[model samples]
Target: MAWGESGELFAINGDDLLTLSLEDQTVETRASDLKKDSPQHLPFSGANILFDIAVGPDGTAFVAYYGNRQLLAVSPAGVVSVLVQSESPWSPHGVDVWGDYVYFLESTVGGRPRWKFWGKDRIAPRVRRVSVGTSTLETIYDGL
Candidate 1:
């Protein structure tokens, strides 16, 4: 979640988007349930699992969804719209706004197993970046 103009808190549920009034602690729906009816299939399949949000210079809030690598833009009026979609199974985990760019991190794996018997890395396997306005994506970094 992130703060909007004047410190208004906003959150994305991956299924429904919402905004909160910090003064009164009121909750409002920004975007309702989104249905993916696309016939063209993708490797990833699931509702949005929004993990982080960042407000841009224009006061627009961008939400990063970990499940489908979907980024959503929330307008001042609480309207949520699709900003970008990863071409593969990349999971978005964190987000922040840097000047004219909305920067975010996408991971290849969700999380690491706790026990040694699982034999999994205790962190995300990989990450990438994308330009907010232009929708240009690039692999900035990666690791196991």
Candidate 2:
């Protein structure tokens, strides 16, 4: 859950990416399962398992999904659409939006553990950033 404009609390349910309006205490889903009827060849199978949601500076909400690794933008009028999707596994845990950029944490397979049973070497993690109005995604940091 995070704060929206005017300091209103917005909660995102983990199951269906529902955005609840705490101001009026009403439950409303931001995205729908429109891709459920799509063929298997399609990337989004309509199974939306949301992980995190971040409100941009303009009050637009950005939601990340774990099922399809897709990011969506929700407007104040309740329109939802895909923002970006590629080969990257965007298992976003947390999200924040800055000026013209949306920053988030994406889980990548760093490497296999050195030890099998009691591994001590921690594999480095990666951070990803996507432009708000562009399709380019760049890795800001790695080996974390």
Best by TM-score: 1
Structural similarity to truth (TM-score) of each candidate: 0.68, 0.67
lDDT (10s digit) by residue, model 2, range 47-85? 345667888866778776555656667776667777766
Candidate 2: residue 21 Cα off by (Å):
4.7
lDDT of 2 at 17: 44
Q: Name the regions of candidate 1 deviating beyond 4 angstroms.
A: 34-48, 110-125
Q: Pull out the clashing pairs in model 1.
A: 14-48
Cα lDDT for residue 128, model 1?
54
State how far residue 29 of model 1 sits from its true place (Å).
1.9
Whole-model lDDT per candidate? 0.64, 0.60
Task: Give each prediction's root-mean-square deviation over alpha carbons.
Answer: 4.4, 5.1
lDDT of 2 at 127: 66
The lowest-lDDT stretch of 10 consecutive residues in candidate 2 is 34-43
Q: List the residue pairs that clash in candidate 2.
A: none
